[model samples]
Target chain A: MKHLIRKDFLKEGYVFATRAAEIARAAGGHTRPARLASNENPYPPSPKAVKAAADVLPPHANRYPDETNKEFIDALKKRHGDYRFVASVGMDGIIDTVIRTLIADGDQVAVATPTYSYYGLAVQAQGGTTVSVPRKADFSVDPEAFCRDAAGGTKLAFLCTPNNPTGGTTETPETIAAICENYEGILFLDCAYIEFDGTDYRPLMKRYRNLIIGRTMSKAYSLAGLRVGYAFVPEWYEPIYQRAATPPFTLNMVSQAAATAALRDTVHVKKIVSVVQEWRQRFIDECPYPVVPGGANFVMVDVAPP
Target chain B: MSPPRKADDVVTELAQKGGVIVRSCASFPPGLPDHYIRVSIGEPWENEAFIAAITDIYQP
Candidate 1:
């Protein structure tokens, strides 16, 4: 039975963060555990967004979601100019789709270390090799090191802005431009936490044909449970993305409605961002341990043994 | 002050005793140290609870 599965699948799968239920069980059945592990928004979606989902549920319960996801795409385009977009179940789904499209077995995808663990997992699932370039001691990416590691026939390079766990923008515009100029492979920038940082890297898309920026409604938009992820793809790669994308109806009708409404409700997103920013600073300022200076909603604390 | 604890031990202590959960950076491969933990910014009360809990554990 094991021989029938892919060799990589035989190895350990991606380890998710401890769930709330697990936390409760660990705490001797304490039900209300403080969840500070997964970097989820500490707020709920806007009332309007919730209402929009509820408004459509009864009528669309028996129907399939729009295959093209027109409403969601239109909302996205309105918010983020008229660039080619690919909406998926979540950013994870988009990553899987990209890996499927670009990586053939034995190809290499370059990644910066101590960033999103999923990029490496996704690459491995595709039977592709992950070429890792370690970030500097400060956790900032070095363009020269990245390009050098990715130089020899890597198919794709994944970078996360305001990177996960570390919670800060590791790469600057100049670093991005340098990587794009030096590395010939496709550059996939995960901007999932960009709203918290408030730096728009979208302009880089205009300059780099190889750049693809991924966004999600999970964090600032408070739609984590809704599973809405989208990406601003380069115009030239739109056709390829369309072909490689997950099957239609990846987002159900309710999710589409909720996400569209959430996109329009910028006030709620702004509030969430501001509050997280404040809390992030407070956590850094007050923590007795040495904390990494970060731009996202989380901070990495060094608790190494003396 | 008590000696600093490993990231995994701190995470376990926090969850089981403090009823607060944070991510151990052990899984972030190739560079992150075993002494590092990632804590997400929670609600005001939740954040305060985390700080209090970790402080108690670290200092005690």
Candidate 2:
């Protein structure tokens, strides 16, 4: 029975972040734990988004979601220009999908260390090797190191802007452009926290045909529970992604509705981003430890005693 | 200043004693120090509570 499972899965299981409820239970069943582990918005989704989802949910309970995902994609296109889009469960799903689409057994994927752990995990799950290059002491990525690794027969590379765990943009736009020009592999730029930083690197999508930029409704839109993620893919790779990555009806009707409405209601998203940005700065300023300067909704503090 | 505590120990203490959940960067590979922790920004009051808790626990 044990042999039935994938060997890699057995060796390395997925580790999730600690939930608020678990924290409360750990603190002797105290209710209302401050959940700052996962970078979830402390606020709720926009009223319009909630209403849009609720309005469609009861009526569409019997029907499967539209496999085309036209409404959400259309709304996204309206916001993010006309680019081929693929919506998935979350950014994690999209990451897995891209890895599966590109990675064959024994293929290599490049990533910068101290970034999102999922890229390595996903690559490993697909029987591919992750070629990791360590970030600088300040957690910034070196374009030369990244490109060097990606050029070594790697099929794909993942770069998270306003990177998770460290909460900083690992590479600058110029560095990203340099990498895209130098490396032949697919470059997946994860902008999951871009809303917090307000940096629109999407223009690079026009410049680089090998680039894919992923975004999510989870962070600033406060739809983490609904799990809507999308990516602006290159026109050439659109059909490839559609055939290899996207399964029919991946996003539910309610989530599609909520995400569509959330996309349209820029005001709500702006408000959430503003609040998170303010608090993030406050945390940096007041934290007693040496905090890493980041543009995301979280701060990474070096808690080592001086 | 107090001696540095392991990130895992700090995370556990914060959750178990202070009811505040933060991420220990020990799991983040390759160069992140064991004493580093990642804390998400929360509401003002929640942030204040976290500061108070970590300050108390991390004090000399």
Clashing pairs in 2: none
Runs in model 2 lying further than 4 Å from the true structure? A19-24
Best by lDDT: 1
Taken over the whole model, the C-alpha lDDT of each candidate is 0.85, 0.84
Task: DockQ for every model, please.
Answer: 0.67, 0.69
Which lDDT tens digits does candidate 2 get at residues A1-306? 998988888775555676434756956855778888888899989999999999998877998889878999999899988778999999988898899889979999988777888898889888999887777777778888888766769889888888888876546788889888998999999989888998777888889988999999999899999999999999988787777765666889999999999999999888888888888887877777778888888999887775
Worst 10 residues of 2 chain A by lDDT: A12-21
lDDT of each residue in B1-60, candidate 1, tens digit only: 666678888888888887888888888887877888899888887899889887777653
Give the CAPRI class of candidate 1.
medium
> Candidate 2's C-alpha lDDT?
0.84
Interface RMSD (Cα, Å) for model 1? 2.2
State the weakest 10-residue window (summed lDDT) of model 1 chain A: A18-27
Q: Tell me how candidate 1 scores on lDDT.
A: 0.85
TM-score per prediction, in order, is: 0.96, 0.96
